[model samples]
Target: MLNLSESINKTLNNFAENTEMMWNFADDATDVLLGDLDTEIASTPYEIVYQQDRVKLKYYKSEAPVKMKTPLLVVYALINRETMLDLQPGRSVVKTFLDNGIDLYMIDWGYPTRKDRYMTIDDHVNGYMDDVVNYILKREKVPQVNLMGICMGGTFCVMYSALHADKVKNLVTTVAPTNFDTDQGLLHSWMKSVDVDRMMDTLGNMPGDLMNFGFLLLNPARLMIDKYQSFLENMNSRDFVENFVRMEKWIFDSPDVPGETFREFIKDFYQGNKLINSQMELGGKRVDLKNLTMPLLNIYGKFDHLVPPGACELLTSRVGSTDVQDVCIDTGHIGIYVSSKCQREFAPKICSWLGERDGNFSEPEVSSPVKKKTSKAKPAALQN
Candidate 1:
């Protein structure tokens, strides 16, 4: 009887201790939440050197002497802003390239509105992208520039390079979905049946918020529930809070996609699987894979849920480039750019690869000052 009484007392003591700990945690969390925190992202400095319509071009000059005579143009998807590459200083892909003596230019597909609803895939790939390339070539006095694309942007780059092979010196694509026939990802399956025509007709431009909601539904356990639970648990840590908030800012800053472009992308790329088969067309010209004869480097995340390896691995086989290489990083979609492990692998590999073929193309003319429309703004996105 005495032992039973002691056991009951111990149980009550444990419960009281847990309650006290919870109160202490709550107090600490409140302090952290209320404290001033620096959560700014895309801190690496850059200049908006060019703008056309709603799209802008960002230029990041290398502090070191430019090693590659050919400058690189990075094309990010219209779904998300280009800020993901320069997310933070220490872990920035932009910083890595700059440190390696690479002169970088990235496309900022600014927020679209009702006016942009009629814009088609041809308008982006053969129009804005083509103009951007021409501007870069003229500004740098180079006949050809190195090309890199990410996600949907990568798909655009593939199309661009194919159509205008003469302007591209070397081509690099990361996590770019080309083959859409496989049922490897949830997006692949869901996009196949997506009634994009109806959605676009009703909404004009595909709403950024609607896209974010759909992405969240892709993996709600991790993206929605557990993510917030982790934030709650670690809210007292300033570092955790700052990083978490920064990511939140980036993820939610989605831009609306032009309706015609979205409709064509869904029908031609995802449902019809036309790109890999060489049946896709832009500006009335067929996007033949055989036309991608420049030096090609295709990189993709092995475990990417959105653009799986199955979608990426087929490009090297179909491209006409004799010099082709494929790299599969062991990570999910966004992790390939933001994770520490990828920091050492992703940008450096490109720098080295480009360095090898930098001299293989038409040499850039002597450096000269060129007039440009310069502006600056917060490097965040409207979508993806």
Candidate 2:
């Protein structure tokens, strides 16, 4: 309703204000992102209680008084670092367990070199895992410790639990693939069709970057393109930028998978589909699911692409235990551990499930590490 000069002045004022606002946002974003930031995770205090050739045992001493008798030992997949479990302060599963008074232990499978290419599943389950279990039992003076594994580590735990049933009091597997017959996941199909033997032979060890590339191909739109696009849109916020960068660090911090282990897993578990059928063997011993007599908790993300529900749901039926629980959370593979909503549900569910089975034994009689045979490839079936 104003004259030409007045209208022009108003328009110019509005344009100038918007430009200034945008410039301010750009400056803030630059400082927040390019400025010195600490993206390094797994910051919770812990002690390297034990170490072997290529792996180290991290025991996170609870800040509060220890309430649980059976200490929890977390075993993560070899493909990625276990830092996902403790990404940050509020979003840390390790912190939740520590706050809940659980004496938590974690196995850090450090970077695998060419020398480790010959380290087969037998070497992992029977050799290193065995030694770690003995060390924990000797220190805690408990007959058995609770074993929880994530993704491929869960598969390893299942094998270790079956082979050495006496050492595992309870078992928990998160997004672990046991039955590989379904077409729900891209990995299952690609693995069946891929030439893993030639790949292993040529590479010596499956490079972490190569494995990550394969995972990205599963859903490029969401993982590669959309995620970063969303980050850009939200980049103006300092908190958003910080969290996004933290996750980026965790995702890219993957380790090379050993060649022998990769070859055996591809042939026996994926191609042969022997885990659920009770035909899988480790260390020359049959990995019978019926040998898993301890209380079991199998968890899978409803939208997990790497290990879909079909791959994880059949464990309860196959295991030898009468006490078994299968939990399907509303999340994806990584979200099951990192997402904020899941932070409320995931660890709580685990603590509850474990608390029910973990007897109210106030003090377990401290005892020496049971002299166990360093059996090369033999199954240590539970005592009847």
Q: TM-scores of the models, in the given order?
A: 0.89, 0.88
> Candidate 2: what lDDT?
0.85
User: 281-321, model 2: which lDDT tens digit per residue?
Assistant: 88778999999999999989999999999999999999999
Please, what are the lDDT tens digits per residue for candidate 1 over residues 74-110?
Answer: 9999987888887766557888777677899999999
What candidate 1 gets wrong by more than 4 Å, as runs, is 1-15, 359-384
Question: Clashes in each model (backbone N, CA, C under 3 Å)?
Answer: 8, 0
lDDT score of residue 27 within candidate 1: 91
Give candidate 1's error at residue 95 in angstroms: 1.0
Prediction 1 global C-alpha lDDT:
0.86
